[model samples]
Target: MQEATADTFIVRIGAVSAGTIAEDGEYPGLWGAWDQDGQFMGRHASREGVAAFLASCFIVDEQDWS
Candidate 1:
């Protein structure tokens, strides 16, 4: 069996709609917040699989009107 270990990855978050950013780039998948170091700090998966994930990370917010 493969040993479980910590791994790092990158995912691009595109334009936000309804508090979620659509997926883009090589992985083309949704991602949540970022850590202090700017590393993505949440679960990532297909757009359809990340809605709840985004909500958990509180990335969803009122639309910016500015």
Candidate 2:
């Protein structure tokens, strides 16, 4: 949906659900990201990777947790 990233996004480094985490990935936990509109953008193998990737073209509003 137009890659909506004009707003802040959340970068979480943990398992959101069961049986979806990769034990062999670079990051043990599941690195997932969602846009400001609560839409899941993507998942990565590393926290830094996901953060950097999302931050590249979008603004990460760490303060807007709600």
Decoy 2 TM-score against native? 0.43
The digit string of per-residue lDDT tens for model 1 on 1-66 reads: 111123222223343322423343445454443432444545466543454554444443434548
Residue lDDT tens for model 2, 1-66? 122244323433242211111222334565665554655566777756666665543533433657
Candidate 2 wrong stretches, greater than 4 Å: 1-28, 59-66
Q: Alpha carbon lDDT of residue 58, candidate 2?
A: 51
Looking at candidate 1, what is the lDDT of residue 41? 40
Worst 10 residues of 1 by lDDT: 1-10
Instruction: Give the best candidate by TM-score.
Output: 2
Using lDDT as the measure, which candidate wins?
Answer: 2
TM-score of each: 0.31, 0.43
